[model samples]
Every structure is written in structure tokens, then in C-alpha cells.
Target: MLVPNDHVDQTGSQASAVRDADAVVRRCRERCDQTVAANEVTEAHWVARITAIAKDEDKSAFAEVFRHFAPRVKAFLIKSGADESLAEECMQDVMATLWQKAHMYDAARASVATWIFTIARNRKIDLIRKNARPEPEDLPWGPEEQPDQADVLALQQDSARLTDAIRQLPEKQRRLIERAYFGDLTHSEIAAETGLPLGTIKSRIRLALERLRHSMS
Candidate 1:
């Protein structure tokens, strides 16, 4: 797409004027041949590919970046205390920002992964502050009306009911429930966050479900 005349940077080389980047990666890899395994592609290659996407809005390039980088972004968010849903949502937001800000990326200052990860980190912190409730800022999740309270579609109807049941669990159980299902933190990390012995955390989660089931009954 042509940028508006005012928006176009006529002074800069045409964005498409980027050099044939394929040879660049292959050439770099050949020198590091022994250090890099047969299956392993270096980050340099990924950066070249992503830079093309960033410049051109190339769907394939963006897809490649999403495939490799999305999970890493999500993992970073989860470690910083985002629940699973928030982590997943924020991962997408970060990737979207990357797409919009790709032109701003300069490999001279940072690696591609570092640039993307920094974007995710900043977004995660912004999300946390936005999600904070008030002075106490305690709540960590969003809310919804009951399944019966909506003009529910067939596909979402069952899920809504199931989630409502989960949402109604005790506060401690709800966090456990979220950690187990939503998957922001792994089992060990959850244990660390709650200051529970790993085994006890596991046990409580197991028991928490039994209670949830009975409550549904």
C-alpha cells in the first residue's frame, strides 16, 4: 500500500530496496557451520525474514514471526503474573504492536527477539496497570453475565455455563482453577507464587475440583 504523500519518506530509500537477504543468512551460517546444527537456523535468518515483513507488511513474514515469537511473549507475560487468558490476549496485542511498529525496529540497536520481547514486556506492564481495580487493585480477571442471562450462541452456550461454574469457586480455588486450566504458570511456578509446598498445592487443586464439581451439582 502506498503511504499518503505526507506520510511517505521520500528522502529514505524505497523500503523494498532491502538487499536480497536470503544469501546473507546462508553466508553467516556457513561460517558458523560447526557451531550450528543441521536443523538449527540462526536468529540472524529469522531477523532478516522478520525485517522484510516489518517493512512490507508481508503476511508470510509476519506469520513466521508469530509462529516463533508468540509463545515466547506469552511465556514472558505469565512469568510476570498474568493469568492465562490475559497472557494469551496480551501476546496478541504485542504481536500487533510489532506489526505496526516494525519500521521503528533497528537491528543496530538490538536483536529482533530483544525488540519484540521488550515490546511484550512493556505491554504486559501496561496491561497490569490497566487491569488494576482501584486503590487496593486486587481483582485479576474479567467478569461476565450468566449463560442464561445472554442471547447465547449454540457454540458458546456450553462454554459459558462451564466457565460460570468455574468462576463461582472460592477465591483460592478460583486461582488454582485458573492456573490449572488457563496455564499462565506451570505447576512449580504456581507453588512458588502461593508459598505452598508443591505437593500441597497439587493436593489442594485436586480437592478444589471436587468441591467445584459438588457446587455445580
Candidate 2:
């Protein structure tokens, strides 16, 4: 079958266009697959890296976690009203706790980021508590009688229980308690920083304290 030359040329051009389209489709599929794989790898990579640090005390693995999280945790503390030095100190404390307590992590409960940030938030709370506590030198020991052993023990137990109760509160309630008792923020200041209503802030703090008291009792 003798075909026209122009017809042959047109057929060849159409064949070329089809091949080009197939190539484009293949490239798009490959990219989509890569993206899916990358997404799947991300969480596992963080978990494995953290597990490596926990099992082997691998400095290299810890270095990677620190590289990714420390600056972020520090910035979070600063945003939460800590001074620069306090923020840096809290960051260091958070990383130290992670190193020491990595064995306690449950991957089923939280992602690596959530776990680390929670520790960072708690460390900030501890820093606020430490700064607010009166130093030994500042305590008025006027005629400090040797306390009864039973009284001292009861007081210590109550203090420990209160601390645990505070820790068990929901994060929002805990933050309000921390700001009210530990930080210098007024209710209005916390309201402004949190974008919550002032009444809500007061209500949460009041409710949190009531819970703590009930728990301690």
C-alpha cells in the first residue's frame, strides 16, 4: 500500500506525540510514588532514630534529634514567656530528660514530635516553679522548732501528691496553673497571650486547683 508522503509525515508526528505523552505520564507516576514513600518513611525514621539513641546511647542519633528539636523547643519556651537564658536552659533540660527517659516512650501513644514537645512544655513549667520557689536563705526560720516527725511526714506526702496531681492535669489546665502560680502573668496577660477569654482563664485555673485539692485530699 503506497501512502502519501504528507500523510506519512502526519502519522509519524502523531506517534511522536503519543510517546511524549506516555513519557510524561510515567514521570508523573514515579514522582507520586516517591512522594508516598517519603511520607511513609518520615515517622518511622524519627522513631528508629530515637530508638537507636535509647538502646545504644548513640550520640550520633541523639545529635540528630537535638539538631531537629532543640532550637524549636527553645523558641517555644521563649514564646511562652521565658527569657532567653531561661529558654535555653529549659531546652537543655528537655534534651537531658529525653536522653535519660527515652526508655519510657510509647510510640503507640504519641509521635516523636508530640512526645518531645510535651517534655519541653513540662520542662518550662518546672523552670517556672523553680524560679518562683523561695530560696533557703529567703525562708524566715523564726524560732524554727524541731517539727514533729509525723507532721513533717504528712506535709511531705501532701506536697508530693500535689505535685503529681498537677502533672496529671490536662495540658490546657496545667498551663493555666503554671502561669498563675509560677509565672508573673496576670489573668489578663494570660488571656492576651492565649487569646482566651479572661473569665475562661480564671475558670480553668480555679477548676484545676479544685481538682488538685481533691486529688491531694
Candidate 3:
């Protein structure tokens, strides 16, 4: 028996709807695949650029990387609560570190963008800490004018007392204090040099300073 005309039209409409849905799904898959391939190529290109700098100290490659990443890093820092000047400064340092530490990058581990942004983040943290507690002023050794003999003797005696107090500190605290005050290293630099945590370095130095103050008083 032949199907009714309306039933035939209904079946045809259902099939058409299914076909339309399949076509839409196929187009979406195609676009997504194309996008993934494009992204992979872009990532590979950046990796190669970084590798070129690492292997050959390639200035041109570095310049290209700097151009692409500098503005992006600055904008990222700004978004992360850095002011314009601080962001600009941190961006410069991040790019410089990227060039300096390109050999440390592992493409297998992270993308070039990831590696660079990580550096930017660390630098920002370091800068924030550095600014939060400005370095202590240097000991007043030389005055603008020639000091009287009595004044010179008093200064020398004060210097001697400070030296004795620093010598009395615990070895770990003493070393950190010397590096931070005498060697003119920032806490981050000390952390990098000594492979110690930043918090530990700060704590030791603070305790050392407190002891010195008590001794001097």
C-alpha cells in the first residue's frame, strides 16, 4: 500500500532536518581542526625563534621575540596590578631575562609564551618585594666637608661597634645581612645566588638586624 501524501512529506522533512544538522556538525569540526592546526603552527614558530636565540645568540630572532612579547608582557603586568611605569620596567627586565635564559627553556615542558610569562610573573614579584622595603641607606662614611678630628674618631668608633655587632650574629643570619647590606644584593638576588627561599632570607636578615640594633643600643 502507498503511504499517505502528508506522511511522505513528513518523513522527507525529518530526513532533511537530520542532513542539515550533520552538515552543520561537519563544518564546525572542519573549522575547529583548521584552528587547531593554525595554533600548532604558530606555537612551533615561536619555539623555533626561541631555540634560534638559545643556540646561536641570534639578535634578529631576539628582536622579533622582543617586539611580539614586550607589549604583551607590559599589558599583562599592568592587568596584574602594576602601574604603567612599573609595568614598563618589569616588561624590560622580563624581555632581558628571556634573552639571557633562553637556553633554559624546554619546549617539551612549556610553550614559549608560558616560559616568558612565568619569568614576567617572578620579576614582578621580586620588584614588588624590593619596592615594599627599600634598601637600607649606606653607612655615612664620608661627609661633604672635612670633619673635625673628634667627629672622625666618633664615626670610627661607631663603625667599629657596628662591625662587632654584625660579627656576633648567627652564621646564616650574618651572611644574609652582609649580602643584603654590604654586598648590595636584593633579596631576590640573594635567593637566586644562595638557592634559599625568599622568605627565609628575609626572616634571617630581619632577625639579624634586630640583634644588631640591640647590640648597638
Candidate 4:
């Protein structure tokens, strides 16, 4: 949601149309007040600009994309039950993918915001799986690697704050979230485990995530 709602990362637009879209978007501000209009904050405008910037290989533009969406993405991860350290790691991976695959975004297929969000959502799910339940068998997976010196220090500091924050979540939320993210389960899985309705499980998870995100911040 933080990225510009433009299709800058998309392709296949005619040259004139692209130029016009860029020009009109830049004039999105209220010239009278020299400020962006409230309505201009819609997702489409940001998508185009971000897509364009990404394709241009402009470092600042890419950095801007990171600055805009990183926090929200991280918050989503943490709310979904990833510890802060894991959320940060997931965020780094997600952004790296965005930069590497920006050209994969096609406006005709999906709006930029939705596409990026899907990436973040998938990455968050993966992070949760990595930390959640044990594997079925002692599979061929490798042993856990030692943390980097800097990473070790950061984890020690960050995990404390994150754990405390999670402990403060409502009991209903804390339990369901633990199952969903930390247990690598989904809403349906939680519902089946608890004998709750599908809707109730989803609502509880959604509310829990939102509350935890706010409380943590």
C-alpha cells in the first residue's frame, strides 16, 4: 500500500501512452497548494511509478520503494506470528526479489500493489513455516547454520522486545496466531483444530494480527 499506485514496473504500453501517463501522474498534485491530492494516493498511481522506476535501474527509486513498503510488510509478518528477527529477514528477501523481478509485473495481469503484496504474503508464510512445526521425517535438510556476528547481536536485542510484545496479545489471538504462523498452519487448519467455524477462525486471525501489529508498534 505504501508504494506509488502506478505501473512503472509493467510493460507493453505504447510509448506515447507511457509518456502521457507519467506526465499526468506527476501533475497529480493540487497545483494551487503544491501538494498531492488526497485521492491521488490510490494504489494504481503508485504501481506505475514504482514499476517504471524499477525498470529504469534507478537506485533511489528502488530505495524509495523499500522505504515505503518495508515497514508495512514487516508488520504483517510480525503480526502473522513471525518473531521480529524472522520478519526482518523475510522483508529483506522480499525486497530483494522485487528488485530482481520487477520486470515480471504486468499491469494487464494484476495491479502492482496486489502483485507485490502476494509476494510478501508468500514470503511471510515461508518464514512462518521455517520456524514452525518439525518436519515429518528427519528429511535431507541441512543443519542450521551459525548466525553472523552482527545478526546474533541484533537477534538477541530484537527477540526480547518482540517476545514481550507478543506476550501482550489477547489470549484468543495469541493462541490462534501461534498456531497459524508459528505452527505453520492456516485459518482452516486452526478452525479444524479448534472446531470453530471457518469465518470465525479467519476473523479472529485478522483481528488478532491487526491488534498485535498496533500494540507492537
Whole-model lDDT per candidate: 0.51, 0.54, 0.56, 0.51
Candidate 1 accuracy as TM-score:
0.44
Candidate 2, residues 1-217, lDDT tens digits: the string is: 1122232223443344334433443443443443333332344455556766766798888998899889988877876888999888888989999999776554433457667877876676666577543323321112322222222222222233344455667898778765664445776766544333334324433444444345446
lDDT (tens digit, per residue) of candidate 3 on 26-109:
443443443433343355456557756876798988998898899999887876777899889889989999989887664433
lDDT of 3 at 81: 72
TM-scores, all candidates, are 0.44, 0.45, 0.46, 0.45
Kindly indicate the candidate among 2 and 4 with the higher lDDT: 2
Q: 67, model 4: CA deviation in Å?
A: 1.5
Count of backbone collisions within predicted model 3: 0
Candidate 1 residue runs with Cα over 4 Å from true position? 1-33, 36-41, 130-217
Per-residue error (Å), model 2, residue 200:
28
RMSD of each: 21.5, 23.7, 28.7, 16.7
- Candidate 2 lands at a TM-score of 0.45
**Which residue pairs collide, candidate 1?**
none
Ranking by lDDT: 3, 2, 1, 4
Task: Name the Cα RMSD for model 1.
Answer: 21.5
- Global lDDT of model 4: 0.51
Taking all chains together, the TM-score of candidate 3 against the true structure is: 0.46
